[model samples]
Target chain A: MATGSFATSGADLELVGIQKRFPGFTAIEHLDLVIPAGSFFALLGPSGCGKTTTLRLVAGLEDPTRGSILIGGEDVTHRKPFQRPVNTVFQSYALFPHMTVLENVAFGLRRRKMAKPLELAQEALELVELEHLASRKPTQLSGGQQQRVALARAVVNRPALLLLDEPLGALDLKLRRQMQLELKSIQEEVGLTFLHVTHDQEEAMTMADTVAVMNKGRIEQLGAPEDLYELPHTAFVANFLGQSNLFTGPVLEATSHAIAVEVAGTRVLVPKARARKHSGEVTVGIRPEKLRLLTEAPPTTAGVNTLGPGTVTDVSFSGVSTQYQVDVPGADSVTVFAQNLDFGPVVTPGTEVWVSWKVDHGFGLEDSASEEAKFAPELDTATIAVQAKRDLAAELEVS
Target chain B: MAFAAFATGTAKEQAPRRKSRIALLLLLPGILYMMLFFLVPLVSLVMTSLQAPVEFGDIGEYETAFRWENYVVAISTYGEHILRSFGYALMATIFALLFSYPLAYFIGVKARPWPLLQKLMLVMVIAPFFISFLLRTLAWKSLLSDEGFLVSSLKALSLMAPDAHFTGTGAAVVFGLTYNFIPFMTLPLYANLERLDTRLVEAGGDLYARPATTFFKVTVPLSMPGIVSGVLLTFIPAAGDYINASPQFLGGPSTAMIGNVIESNFLVTNNYPAAASLSIILMAVILVMVVVYIKRSGTEDLL
Candidate 1:
């Protein structure tokens, strides 16, 4: 994609230690972010994670409890949204219902006391490809048409920054996918800094050059999409960004480049470059795709790395891939995805399987004693009860 | 199989017939009521407007004669009163609009938890209806009198020099009309503005428009339908009201409206022909103005 070269107007937006608290609840805590003159940034999170609050703070819609917001290296923390050179496209588009498409697009221009508001509005409408619908009212147009009208209405003023708060949330899936590409292209062509907010990981991965994953009102991690996916630092990031299987065990041997951990009286080796801390017990993390399943049990256990023998409890056949649940001894059940190859019969329930993975593919983290303190005393009794319940439910469902 | 298919087709065909019969049955009472009450009275009023006056003493005068010139004589003779009626109505509408807009905007947009305020406003609007219109106008007269509480308060505040009076003037008539018609303007405006999308204003603010500009460009245009309705509501009734223009209230010959003139012609002067002609002319004028207003504003379908 050919994007217009954005001039270095000197790092247009900066947020320094912004904090927002509502009554007893804190929505954003000590948040620091900086965007260059032109950068496509995404704030990704689950619900109630304060991505929207950060955007609102940047746009000057909400005043921060602490810290300052600077635009073009000038403090604008107390300035109103209208005083700032930023515009927002809300999730609902929020086009004026009473006005024609042309009037809606011309609203900001007219408010600014421009001499030729109609001409400017026409040019904007042309930019969004809504010129033919200029005379039609908002309700007379389709959803996508209304969206374009909203876009034109904002971009007509040529603001310094554009904030899009889940603008494609209301569209159908196909329309959403189409608009994602369109929005990126438009942002590129116009050379405007876009700060987008979304909960969809795929949307952030596809559009944002840099992604910030937020959890519990704080940014857990911020990096490029592939970097965050390949090397997640925190347990929340590893779990939230994508799926990963975690194993808890004690480190029996440690070295500069590798560590051997003992799980259920069996030794497992993990690469040390990915390990965070390595003295005592540590948690090992591996992605589901890294594990391999074999039909026959291995003859010898030497040099096999980590091996688990269990029966296939359940199998799910997706169109292009298949997922199998294997119940291992003294370890949590693991989910493994396998390609649906035509060379063999499909794996089904009640089939014996061996799950094994290499040592270099796994990473370790320090074990927090808090988790053990919370669950250790009652684990022995609860595990048997949970297993019995699962068995009964499965039998009842089959019957 | 063939018999079953034929039976299904027959059943589908008969379903619509049965539904049509039920629909006709449901419509019968309304049609009958319209014929008996509305259509019959309108036809009779038009017919009576064309007939000669019923004379009490002369048999020759009792003979029926179609006299359309009575309309012209009635209008010309009471032209000032007709014009005063329209003038008062226009003034009342303008005043109501000016007073009602801020009140409606405050109640609709600024007041959170709006259902309680809406109920309170509904109570206040209906409170006037509970009291008789004649009594209310008389109350206004007393309140505006020279020795009344309002005048005394103004005198105490040094705003009035003890010689000022508000009663028996066009100002009093306009005040009374406004007091009665204000709710008619506010309720519709409140209803329309309340239903307006708040997101539109937020969007405007986000697009670098100040609050004042947003109110003018977005809020006002969106609520024009309610404004037009409120204007018509205040203007039409104010034009046809005679109680507000009665002499004992605040009106004289100069302030007498068309309704007063029509009432006098019918009751005091016993000129039925003139009264009927005046009624026809007033109705025609109101109809034409309403049609033109609807056409010009492009809000005919709002009603």
Candidate 2:
């Protein structure tokens, strides 16, 4: 693992039954996750979903109320943040404003009494393509430059697990996309475990090998990004990952290969492997892009699930694709994303349309009603959001 | 039509000029106040410093003559007291900083969550200001006197010699100065520390710095502006303070500072020129010292 001069592989990070509780609410509850050595892992969630708390717990910035954390099989649950072999690229970059870029990057190495701190810091800066800015103070740099400096600062330490708490959340859109790719390549080159926490789903999907979608202090689903997006286990994951056309209904028949679910008087078949619940009431869901908006009724194909006789309520043309919101009978709304192939007629609002998708594309959630109820009110209140982002108030409560 | 166009162009050009004139007019009160209270007194003091004693006149009489030798005489005659004032002020500034940094840090950073406690602490620091400055110095004088409980306790504890007393010592005066001007030291430090970003300290700990290293490397460097301003606020006023260094207060004849010397010259001996010369010397020395200190501290942007 340590063959080259600056090459040090990561250690396995294990969180065993971790739980974090604030004064009035639980931030994380019963989280047991393991990222294999040298893998890029991401904890994906909305605000206040305990992703940041999980990162802090692993970084030793916050202690779990009822669990242990182990890195490479050694317990670090009670260790100070500095004692453990972990570093964080904080959300705000938190670069020492008084220090030059070189000094800030060299801080950890110097503190650890490491050899050739300046040279190593320069190397890290070069990795981020910021060697020319080594002498500038953090405040002097642009947001993108400061972000790279923060990355260099954390990566230079070569810690066992580098925790990134929304490290690129402050960047503009173009810079954010560029940093995402650069962060992925750097993680691969360093071969260290990068535990990234972010609320941006696209960022998480693009940068991580395994993404865990968290909701209300629990992992809603954990899998490869494609798997999580394709077959979500919970309604929260299905909605959060991307727009979903969901239909809540009771299972009409449970067969070996698939389950027939009745949604608004129409039957839809979800693959048995994709159905989180097979014999009871379930919520069937499909990605917006997976459904097709048909001007006429779809053919009575053997393997297609269709919901029709709806009016197109809204149509949005987004350069590469066209999104249609269809108000179907007995169904609130069904969204469909059609590629701008330019071969079909332009469908305007108030046009009759049918939303259809292949049966195998449907995924079913077991606990549909309660999860949907919890997701709706989260967006309306301001207090809930403030409470969610107040995870850094540990010291205030502890004292 | 051409004449009308020319008149409009001139009016347009005069608009900004008239606005600037209004700006100057708005500044008239402040400028007049400075001239009346500051510039006039400064000019009068300079004139008095150069005045020579009138021949065969009263003790307070002097005639206008450029006696530059007054400065030379002030320095040569009262050099010890001048040095003693600065020395005591320097010690008091250091003591105030040492005492207030922790208190300010605790109030600004540690007690941040309990806002009520922070406010209470600030109130306690400024509580001395409610009473008159002279009263506070007089109170300290009595507290440190030979028969006072504090001196008696120290004597009984063997921390002080049995024959020793505190009423007239240099330490007593410095203590009085530090105690009196502590709020000056604390308020600026607290203001700066209050605006400090605590995430930087957390970053220090995340980067392998222990608590003490984090404090020295991060917190202290970040609080330099506060420290510099606090030092200035305490040192400048404390250097010229007389009540704490007077025989009527905490100090005695041997512990006389430049302020006590100036007081005696002005009121007792009626030496107006000498007192004015000494005041000018004190101001010049403080200005030079402050400039050098600010330059060395590298917080010139604060000014």
Candidate 3:
């Protein structure tokens, strides 16, 4: 694991210690975020994880119970939504049913007391490629077209920050993809900071320059999409962002450069930064794509510290990749995803194989004292029992 | 083979036979009722309005010669009453709308606990219905009388003298009409305004529109269907209502509406032809007003 120094910079809008509490629940808790200007930022999380609440706080639709929201280094926490230089494209699009498309886009300009509202509205409609449908009502347009109308309505105001709350949630899958690219390009062309809230991980990873993964009313991690994917700081991020095969172990030795640990009765070495000091136990994390399977045991390569003999328990072909679940010694199953690049012949189920990966591929975590921690003592026992049962059943079937 | 073919053909034609019988059965009772009640009565009313009087209390009076002059006399005699009825109806509609709009908007849009407010409003609307129409009108009369509680309150406030009178005047009649019909106006407006998509309002506010601008641009225009219905309900009933403007109530000859004239001509004066003619003309005027209103408001679908 390669570690980088923590530094906050290039943020135009900063949310400092933001907190919001509803009657019986705290929707957000001490949320600190810095959104860089001219960046497409996404607040990605599960449902009811305060993603929408954060967006609403920034939009001034809801006030924070204890925090300040600063836009471009000026405090805007007390300002009304209309008073702030920000606009929102609501999830439902919320186009006025009583007005034509042109009028809907022109509404903000008219309210701002602009001299040439019609001309501005026409230009906006043209930008969204909705000029021909200007005379039609919102109900007359398709879902995608209505989404464009909403985008046009928000962009016409020329605000410094544009907020979008699941604007493409109503579209079909193909249309959603198209609109995602369009939204990204539009944000680039306008050179405005966009704060988008969505629960779709792929949507966030595809469009946003930076993704903030939130869980349980807190930001779990915030970084570039690729960095977050390659290096997740927690087990939650590892599982949430993509798939990971985790291993439990106890650290035997530690240094500034590397740490040695025993995982599933086998000695393994991992980077020092990945090892957190704890009483006895730690968790080892490895991406499935990094593991390799070989039919015969090979000599250990430099920096490759862990190898184990296992039987292929399950083999599933997923088009571009093939996933293998290997049942290793001490009753642990590790998954490995191998690219299907005509790699000789595929391994069959119940085949004996050796799985190995580099030391840097595995990151260690401190054994958590919390009850709700993912790697509990009972989970290890359960895995051992299930693996023993499966091995016995397979032996009997083979006999 | 020929007999089997004929049997198949007959089975295919059996569905139409059952359908034809059902269609005839459905039409039979309605046709009989229309002929016996509606068509016969309409033809007799037209014929009776045309007949001249032969002898008083004679059954054959309607068989006399057709007298077209009766319509002319009816109009010349009761024209003022017809005009007063229309004027009162219009005034009542305007007043009801003025009072009900804000109340409906507030209750429908601004009220947080909407179910409770809706139940309360429903109770208020049906409260008058629980009392007899005449009893409600009489109650209004008592409230507007010279020595009524309202007049006394005004006198106590030094806004009026102790002897301020409201009975037997056009204002009292209009007030009675408005009070009776206000709920009719409110319910539809509340229904429509409550069903209004609040997102549209929020969208307007997000676009930097003030509350007032949103009300006019989105709220009012979307609620036109309700407004038109309320106007129709209040205006039509208030115009045709003689009970509220009768002499037994807070009304006089100056406050007598077209319904009063129709009632007196038919019951008191025993002038059936003139009464029928006046009724026809009043119906025509109301029909024309409804047509004009529907076309102007572009809410003909609501009708």
Best by DockQ: 2
Enumerate the candidates' DockQ scores in order. Answer: 0.39, 0.42, 0.36
Among these predictions, the greatest TM-score belongs to 2
lDDT of 1 by residue, A1-399 (tens): 001222232236788999999888999988898877667889887767888999889877788999999887889898887777787877788988878899888877776666688888998898767899999998998887788788778777666788888777656778677778877876777677888898777789899988998876888789999888876666656666666667778889987778887775667778888787786877777777777888787665533565567778988877677878987777768778877676433677888887777776776654432342432222222344476689999999999
For each candidate, what is the lDDT? 0.77, 0.87, 0.80
Sorted by TM-score (best first), the order is 2, 3, 1
Residue A399, candidate 3: how far off, in angstroms? 49
Question: Where does candidate 1 chain A have its weakest 10-residue lDDT segment?
Answer: A1-10
lDDT of 3 by residue, A1-399 (tens): 001111122227899999999889999988999998889999887667798999888878889999999987889999876666677999889999878999999888888877688788899888778899999999999988999899989988777788999888777888787778877777787678889898777788999999998877899889999988877776666666776777666678776788777776777887876655533676667888998889888687878855577899999998889999999887378888999998633899999988888888777654322322543223232344477789999999999
lDDT (Cα, tens digit) per residue for candidate 2, span B11-45: 55666643577778999999999999999999999
- Residue-level lDDT of model 2, residues A104-148, one tens digit each, is 999998988888899999999998889998999999998878888
| Superposition TM-score, candidate 3 onto the true structure | 0.85
Q: If the candidates were sorted by their lDDT against the true structure, best first, what order would they fall in?
A: 2, 3, 1
Better of 1 and 2 by TM-score: 2
Interface RMSD of each: 5.3, 3.1, 7.8
